[model samples]
Target: MSRPQGVGDGGQGHKAKHTVLALAVAALNFGIAQGFFAPLENHPSLLQARLGLEAAQAQLRATQSPVSLQAQGGVSFFEVTPPPGPPTCPNPLNPQCITLPSDGRQITLGLTFTPFPFGDVSDAVNQAAIGVEQAALGLRQARTQLEAQAVEAFLRVRLAERGLEVARLGVRLAQASLEAAKLRESRGAASPSEVRQAEASLRQAALQQADAERNLTLAKQGLADLVGPSSDPPPRLIVPSEGTPPQVRQAELQLANAQVAYDRAVRGVLPVVQGSYTRNTSDNDSLTLSLNSRTLQPSLSYTNQSQGRSAPQDRIVGTLQIGLSANIAFGVLDALEAAQKQVEAARQAVEAARRSSKQQEDLLRSALQTAEQGLANAQQARSDAERSLAEARERERLGLASPLATLQAELALAQAQLNLEQAELGRTQRILDLYRFYALPLSEVNR
Candidate 1:
């Protein structure tokens, strides 16, 4: 629903109202938006797709070398004539040898696109999903906190409003007392000392009224910050439903998400499947096939090399090769080790995050309990004050109590009523907190 036009700068004056519905809606919207943006930022497959072009810059160098094929045949029995090693032909697709095209040697095929493992991509997407989910939860929690704050602010404004009224009433009562004293003094029934006392009380009451007005002003401003300036009418504290709050059940979700992330990171050690084909001109042509099924690769290549660039005397040759290229030109072991360490570190971070979430739950629970107890105590005090006020009014009506006495009793009663109202508000806020921490439905609590 659209809100009424508010006061102040339309953009900068944005303020969320202190209402259960508003709070809940804000939280849900924030959560949904956060989740939607996850893939664009942190998802692995998404990131890989974005980074593909950058990696191409380096992969382009792969074409510079000619594909070489080496064939080794193991005979069950020693042969008088052993087949020569696979002729270094242009078989770039072959993982067995480094093809150097600049040496006017065999042309090797370009590196074939080996689709990244689904397992790893799935893990990344899952991790990102979890993070976005958690962020949304956090935003909801923040909204809840804001809701609680708005409720409290409203209560404060009410207290200040009532306080100001009481102060004004005190001033009036004091003036009445002074007038009575003056009348009695004129008839010689009241002494000068009594008149002085009445005058002092009036002055004191005026000061108190001023103080109360200032307090009220501050309270109104505080509420204004939350719900925007609703000069439409003063806001009131809503009686929130008596029940648990809505929260992200972070303690459990954290542990669950972390375990999943850790599992995914560990699973990344598996080699990705790879295959490629290449044909070159230095020799007639060559085709190499490679599959990354394990740490080591098992591959094959078929090549037909002419004596020169011509296809004349081009003999067909095929070689079966098993190549383990863990380390060759550059120290790729360091890179592999770094990747493994990165995965391991992520696993550790997940565990840490889970622990932190657990601690937060415990702390929030403690706060909720304490606030609830305080509210109960405040309510009891209010009931007693109300009874006292009733008795004082009855006595004043009967002329058994002085106006001063009755005025004091009324003042106390007003303060107590304000306190009770505040307590009720506080309890409602604490309940909202619980809902935020548990990720429970706001509807469940608000209803």
Candidate 2:
């Protein structure tokens, strides 16, 4: 009779509406999940740490670069004229100063290079290498510190949220008590004072709720500042596994770097032997050789020279000669002594750092243990409070308890819940702190 038109249209509309609702619900759940599990990469502290690492890497590269080479070169031009009215030419074959050229010009080109020898370059290279290693350690420390900050902020936010929930629950219970008091007053079963007291409690509960909300906002802002801004909801806080603390690793790295620095300093005052060969070509050609002992302050040089211009009858000549020099500096002894003392100091520093790291680790372990015990006790208190609240509510419904008594029980339960949340948060934070000490990533908790 309906020609199936209404059945087809109506059925299609119902299916479409259901499909839209399902899609909306799925999207909401997905968004909640995403907010609850924000990745560490989004954290502002980690981003800053990454930037620091990049800077450190750049510094290391600069440090590792080769030293600048030392070089000098020049050209000189000059003219020679006969002195006074006399000719000083040795050749007598030509009279009237014909043997000497009236106008003569001379040009000279010279160059010198001081190569970077092994012994001479070792100190600088060693220092640069140590710098690179130190930079790497700095980057690691920054990352560890950033992760710890992010974890702490996340935990605070979770605590604030739970506190807000307890506050709201308290407000609800206070309102119920106020309504009961008013009814009892109307029946002359309770005095007007009870109603006034209930009203005051309600106001107090509202104030607490407002304070909790403000705390939650501040906590969320702190976390967002560290992780960067995000549209997604905040993730649940998870307790990271206990791992190697960053402080220990950082201390070890410092000790290693100090040792390297001390070794390099010692090498600075040590003996260095260097050799060089040089060649020069100008009006005359020459070869020069040199050796130096820096520790002894002794040096030797040899040179061979030949005249550039010559005639058959007047031949050019060649000559070779050797020279030596030496020096003594009292400052060298002082420098060497200072370096030795520095080495000793570095060794002591290493030992001190080791002891400090050990103590810190022990303290953190003890703290974590204490936090775990406290959390257990809070959980037990919370369970007891729940049972008490339930019994109070039952007695009130049975007319065996006053509305005020039931309200008091409810408040106690809320307080117990708040304490339990704090205990849980504290325990988790302590665990994360231990993990952070070991330089473990917060993301490891997900695993």
Best by TM-score: 2
List the global CA lDDT of all models.
0.58, 0.64
lDDT by residue (tens digit), candidate 2, 145-213: 665676567778778988888889889888988899899999999999999999999999999999999
Per lDDT, the best of the predicted structures is 2
- The TM-score values for the models, in the order shown, are 0.52, 0.66
Model 2, position 25: C-alpha lDDT score: 69
**Per-residue alpha-carbon lDDT of candidate 1 for residues 394-415, written as tens digits (9 for 90 to 100):** 9989999977777777778777
Let me know the TM-score candidate 1 reaches against the reference structure: 0.52
Error of 2 at 309 (Å): 8.1
How accurate locally is residue 64 in candidate 1, as Cα lDDT from 0 to 100? 23
lDDT of 1 at 33: 37
| Model 2 error, position 144 (Å) | 2.2
Task: Report the poorest 10 consecutive residues by lDDT, candidate 1.
Answer: 233-242
